[model samples]
Target: MNIAIISPGPFSVPPVNGSSVEHDIDEVTKMIDPEHQVTIYTRKCATYPKSSVEENREFIRYAYKGPTPYLQKIIKHIRKHKPDVILVENRPTYVLALKRHFPKIPVFVNMHSHVYGSTAMISKAKMKKVVRLASGFITNSEFLRRHFMRTNHIPGHKIHAVHLGVDVSPYQEAKLHSSIKKLRKQIGLKEDHRILFYAGRLMRGKGVHVLLKAFRHVSEKDPLARLVIVGGTGYGSNRLNPYVKELKRLSEPLGNKVKFVNFVPSVKMPLYYQLGDIVATPSVWKEAFCRVNLEAMASGKPVISTPRGGIKEVVTHQGSGFIIPPKEWSKELPIIWELLWSAPHIRTEMGKQALMRAKQFSWYATAQGYLKVFENAVAKREAGKQPLQKTG
Candidate 1:
């Protein structure tokens, strides 16, 4: 089968660090059956050229001079390729356009988060229309699937929950001691220090401030504990962003115990995970799914995250790690951190369980799940069944 995947205009396929949605698209496309042809339509960034073919898949990029013109380029390519199915990611407006222009073609809309959130690039009304028009909907987690169904008034059957995948090999517990020692020495971390790792955007809603507050309490209890923040404002920015400045100000009294490493490349992320004794994601807002948590778990480290969105689905409380409720992070996080800090044996056992759980979610399995959804949508379209419409 021939497939065409449409990505958001801001990033390219196989993103460097962030861009989870783009990363998922790239992984699914690459890992899918080689017999099936896949082409990804994304913006032409400095790293990716206009057209490149590799790993039995193709990437076609467009320069975003303007929305209308760029979309026109996309439509032209879609017409030329004439794919069997179309997969659109996170761009509801473009989904609407694709469905309108190619009414007979099956277009699957992949929702990475709530359509009404601040990160949504399209309007609610347009998103509703896209939901009604698209052949099917795909979400990264059951939490998002339920949220979309409730908010958009769409039926549960029309949406599928396919968890995102991670490459767990790099994160495996091999050369653990050597990697830890090397990273600790390079980063000027002491051997006795307990590192709390947080890797992602330094945004307020991500609950970096909450992590700081919790870390302060933990530091007071365990003088050897340290917080290492690894990220920038967002994708592509490696400097001290406004949020980083705020975090730095919040950690002022804590001194060098709170270390900030700006924007590590995705390839080098496993090293940071190896350096961490525990991974903490104290996001106040709902995370559709966090890849950081999975990466940390795959590295044989227990994660301490909030029970927000689909996070609970990933981090099993008292098993892989503790899921502290967002409201009680100030009191609960430090307690959990202290417990895990005191008992290295418990951490080791949980880390093993975390690695085992991480194995269940692989890019290969994720691609196969997506393939099943795509095939079903295409079959429905061929049988003259209109896309599921939103019911009143």
Candidate 2:
């Protein structure tokens, strides 16, 4: 089977660290069944050739001015070497355009977030039409599967929710004493300090402000506790946005106890995950999934996250980590902090369990899920063609 994966235009493949969509694209393609030839289309990155086959996967990068130009760049490439199946990541409208151009091929749209399919971004009628044209709608979590079905009115069979995977080996590897110590020294972490890490976009939805508020209380009680906030407003964005100002204000009393690290790419995330003795996502959004929980688990750290969206799927309350109810995070954090600090052995045991759980969610499993979606979608679409076409 020949497969073509089209990443959104904003980022390049092999991920520049800021784009989780690109990172998923890069990881999935690497673990794809080698018998099938894989081609990836992404926006241009200066470091890589426009067209190059590295490790058996072909990457085609085009200079992108905007989404329209970038889609055209992909169209020109597809006209020449059309694949058996095409996977569109992030943009729902891309599926519509691809279906219009290549009526026979199976085009699957994989949604990383709820932002695209929501009526806020596109009209409900247009979203339904996009769903009608595409072979399958894939989401990063089952929660999102129900979302599109309700919002876009897509049939249950046409949508699949495949959980994203993490390359745990990097996080696992970074646990070596010297490597972790060097990272700690660089961050100015004290030997006795217990780090509380928060990584993700520094915005309202990610609960950055909520994290600061919770940490201010955590710091006042436990002098050894340190809060490390990772990520900028967006990928590579360093400007202090308004929410960041609010977060700074919240952290004022804690002062040096709170550390806001700038945005680091996906490559450095492994070590950063290790920076936390215990990680806290503390998200308030009903996001499709939080890769932070997965990465933190992979690094053998317990996470304190809300039971929102797919986070409930990855985090087990008092098993691998704690999944606090959204309404209870404020009341619960102080209690959970006391428990973890008093019984440090639970942290070690939970870390072991977290790593074991993290091992189950591998990039190889992610690829297999996509491959299964490809096979089933192709078979279903082909079966629906010709005599069954009009009804479909």
**TM-score for candidate 2, residues paired by index:** 0.95
Q: In angstroms, how far off is 125's CA in candidate 1?
A: 3.0
TM-score against truth, every candidate: 0.93, 0.95
In model 1, the clashing pairs are none
Model 2 lDDT per residue over 33-152, tens place? 889889999988877788889776999999889888899889888989989899898888888778878988999899999997777877877888888888888888999899888878
lDDT of 1: 0.84
Tell me the TM-score of model 1. 0.93
Model 1 misplaced regions, further than 4 Å: 115-120, 173-180, 239-241, 385-392
lDDT of each: 0.84, 0.86
Report the lDDT tens digits of candidate 1 across residue range 116-215: 3222566677667777888888889999999888877778888999998888888774436466687777777998888999999889878999999888
Error of 1 at 279 (Å): 0.4
Return the top candidate by lDDT.
Answer: 2
